[model samples]
Target: MGILDGMTPKKLIIWILLAIGIGIVLFILMLYLTLKTKTTSLERITPYKESLKRELVTLRPVHIFELMEPTKSNYTYAMSDTNQYYFQVLESETGADIPLTKLKDSIPAGATIYFEKAVNYTNGVSGSSTPRFFGTISYKEKKYPIEFVWGRYTYKSHPENLRPGFTMDLAPWNNRVDTTIYYLPRGSF
Candidate 1:
């Protein structure tokens, strides 16, 4: 009867013990905001750094003087400035004959005797230019072709005399090269 008509049972047990102490302080503030949002996401993240440091520089191949394959690969454009050099030797395993005087008096100006890959047809700059040195063939990955032979003569003058039976016949060398292309390292800019 309205708790005995506005009566007191000790004010209805002190309003049910102040509503059970505000529901135990809102369940301990919801378990302290769920453990402070998981320790602030495991203290954010920042530790593991070390970047930037490169050196790269290692290339080879550059041998010249050995021609014979021009029936129609295209040629004849000489005006005279003198600097031709386009050698491509890669046919020596045992077919016999490779004597151009055992390579003109210890050749080494840009020597690559035979790796097969040459290009440098010049006049002022029409196509292949920059650095160009040559050599480097792997097949799956690596093709540094550029044995230089544009206008010709990379710079040759030392040949006082030594032409002994210049034969050099590796059986028309042609190591099979469809396309790989890569020549840049004479000066490199």
Candidate 2:
């Protein structure tokens, strides 16, 4: 009664309403100004884009005769598991033999490779006849397991069973067929 003695209830309510409206307006203006001054870049907006980009294309463990993308097959790379940077997935092939000389320096550090193949070897005692491949890839803490099968006993071979066998074309440079396809590991393993 002391402060409102001269003011009617209706007038006091009106003043309160006016103050709230002004506060709202001020808040909106401040927010707009702050937003306008801030710079939002693509990278800044999507910081997770780089790390999760590779996970978007999940390399399934099981597939049915899937062909590697032509463009990607040449470059052969995969995105990082937790970073924006990209890493190369080197494609090393063997002609029933060991693959191209692996260049440790060529591959980026912190990168890992899992490679396996099964060839229908000439015979178990001899070598691979028809190759089937199986592999598991691990990036950071994640793993990608894939299996490629040719026939029976095409992909799975005991780790202790060291019989290196493979069949591959050396890019098939000419029209004439090249017979340097089969690969047999050296030494009596």
Candidate 3:
């Protein structure tokens, strides 16, 4: 009654549309800034691959699940020189594995996962360098590729929600990211 007392139906519609337009623009801008933050942050921290002087260790896939995410899911890259990554591998062979159904055609039948440990963990690989992890799958007489990130066990870390099962993560070897593949533990789908 006060503000719209003399406003026509057409005028009211125009105002509503304009408001919606502004809202959409604001939403897009916020999203852009959030993603940009991650990219910028990583750029500032050049990767120091040589920071860690030790033999590259190979770990077996102990567990597979969704990796942790940030509040805005953008700060995948934080910490200086290194980050405390949390993933798991069995101390002994548990006979655990993901059935072929879950692996789809990506992996051949009668294949087993072989972790290609990345040097991106504390005392593993130092500096911020897009932490990467993956491994190989043995089928027939040949070995195929699979993804596996090295990290601390979530139960021990007591940190973010890392869904159990499988997750496609960035597989950056050195500075080049060859592909983004699912990091799955040895088990059924």
Q: TM per model?
A: 0.16, 0.20, 0.29
What's the CA RMSD for each of the models? 29.2, 24.2, 14.4
TM-score: which is higher, 1 or 2? 2
Predicted structure with the largest TM-score when compared to the true one: 3
Off by over 4 Å in 1: 1-7, 10-12, 19-21, 28-32, 39-189
Off by over 4 Å in 2: 38-189
Minimum summed lDDT over a 10-residue window in model 2 is located at 79-88
Better of 1 and 2 by lDDT: 2
Q: Model 1, residue 92: displacement in angstroms?
A: 56
In angstroms, the error of model 2 at 151 is: 55
Give per-residue lDDT, candidate 3, residue 106. 29
What is the per-residue lDDT of model 3 for residues 1-189, given as tens digits with 9 covering 90 to 100? Answer: 499999999999999999999999999987665444231111112222221222222222222222233222322221111111322122111224632112123222233544423323222122122333344445456443434333222222223645322222222223333232322222111
Q: Can you write out model 1's per-residue Cα lDDT over 21-49, one digit (the tens) per residue?
A: 99999999876654331211101111000
Query: Given candidate 2, what's the lDDT at residue 142?
Result: 49
